[model samples]
Target: MTYYWFAQSVGVLAFMVGITMFFNRSDRRFKQQLSAYSAIIGVHFLMMGAAPAGMSALLNSLRTLISLRTRNHWIMVIFIVLTLVLGLSRAHHWVELLPVGATVVSTWALFRTSGLTTRCIMWCSTCCWVFHNIWLGSIGGSLIEGSFLIMNGFNIIRFRRLQLRGIDPFEVEKKIVKKMEENQAAE
Candidate 1:
């Protein structure tokens, strides 16, 4: 009983970190935070005895971190293959595939998309996680996934609004780059 509560406590921490991830307008920061959240949730799932979900989450953490360095097609393919083999090997039921599916979709999004498109793809992943958490009886995980659905949807709309307004959602990055260039010229 105490072990169960401890695992739930870790999930609550993941919930907090995961919620903050959606608030990041910068893709790099979002991915960084997502990697951390995935690691935490991976541990949480493992402690709860959801082996497939736990392994998927841990793999996702590493995948997200590597994506920060490169989006090479081969790297993405390797991760996908690895995720499938490992996740499927541990899956005991059809429902166990939910987290594996979620991880696969997320891996694609992180490697092949960015900003608004990435968020849109992740919306699907979030849905899979919601069902997976419910099936696993993880109250904290379910709540976080549900929150991700709503918050991620709102962020997608926000990005679309910026586009409609003829404003780049990533304009801040451009400004930072220009400022750094100016400083270099001054030096």
Candidate 2:
């Protein structure tokens, strides 16, 4: 019981991190934070004895980090294959495959897409995770993914609004960089 509580505590922490991650308007910052959140959630699942979900989350952490550096389709394929092999090997039930599926979708989105498309794809992944968490009786996990669905939905709408205004959603990152450079130059 104590062990389970500890796992739940970690899930709560992950919930906070995930909420912050999805709230970011900058793609780069979102990916950066998401990498950390994946690792934390991986630990939470592992401690809960869900090996497949834990493995998928850990792989997702590395995959997200790598995605920040390149959007190469080949690299994405490698991650997908690795996730399937690792996740399926430990999966004992259909519910266990949910995390694997979520990770695969995320791998494709992060490596082959950007901005609004990426978030939209991730919304599907989040749904998979929410179902998996609920099936596994992970209180923290369910809350985290549920919150993620709502937060991610808001971000998608925000991105769409930016698009409707004739502004590229990713342009926000460029504007931040430009302002930072200007400040440095002024100094």
Candidate 3:
């Protein structure tokens, strides 16, 4: 791959890293890293002479990683399979899915719990990404996705803190305040 391709791949990888930091909500290190990564991605996205397909792959991967319901295995499976089927394209459009297969399934695997449901899906995605990458003879997207697994692992750690403290991580600040007020009035 060219320098431009590496930069573009890493640049797209950076946006998802930023998402991991935001979700962590309490880790300064993660926040800084995420910011740095996001900036890199932005720079690459703006400056790199990359194919539009690569950019699309990055955006699509971001959607899968950030979208909550994608925590499910079935979606990951379907997406992976769709990516695989698209690989039949002789025009190399299939290569575009490289980043997406890695990032999406990897992110999903990281966020989901250890239950059979989550396990089944992550494993499935892994399989799909592996099979498809081999078919395309590229590792760029898988490498991108692997980074998400690491970043997302940190995100899961941060989420565990909220879980232990008995707060819904997704509950907004005002909702928490309302709950507190209701409790005080009840008392």
Candidate 4:
């Protein structure tokens, strides 16, 4: 097989992992898994000679890791600056900017926001990635992003339904806290 085919096949595997993780209910778990698998996707982008996409994915991994550790906006600002610098440095075509814009949206969503806002921003990012994938001829990658968008929309609808019933869709995190309290009481 050709090199592009091999590299895209690997990218497809990473895309599947990343998409699965993206759907995780736990925010921390989702970010951790996304960071890990996205590194592989970045390498795949590099192998495919899509430098802008590769850099964006790498920076996205870094952003996820940092956001996981803390919610400090300063750190996020620094990363945004870095992303802008790097993106502008190598960006020759307008299409190359697509991944960079997606990264920016994702960084803000993961770091500076929460609740429905985060989910909304993620959907926007998914749209950008879909465009990027199509530009790069990554059929699997585009489909993965499309799937992510649909799943996110479904989850949002489910959350809205829970709200209509006076339930917080985010109660899972609270459940975790409650379980910890129960364990403490037992001890």
Clash counts for all predictions: 0, 0, 1, 0
Question: Is 1 or 3 the stronger prediction by TM-score?
Answer: 1
> Each prediction's Cα lDDT score?
0.88, 0.87, 0.45, 0.78
| Alpha-carbon lDDT of model 1 | 0.88
Task: Flag regions of model 1 displaced more than 4 Å.
Answer: 172-187
Q: Considering only N, C-alpha and C atoms within 3 Å, which residue pairs clash in candidate 2? A: none
The C-alpha TM-scores of every prediction are 0.90, 0.89, 0.36, 0.86
Q: Per-residue alpha-carbon lDDT of model 4 for 1-26, expressed as tens digits?
A: 99989988878888777777645667
Give the Å shift of residue 111 in candidate 4.
1.0
Best by TM-score: 1
lDDT of 3: 0.45
lDDT by residue for model 1 (24-135), tens: 8887798899999899999999999999999999999999999876667789999899889999999998999999998998999887777788899999999999999998
Better of 1 and 4 by TM-score: 1
Residue 143 shift from truth in candidate 4, angstroms: 2.2
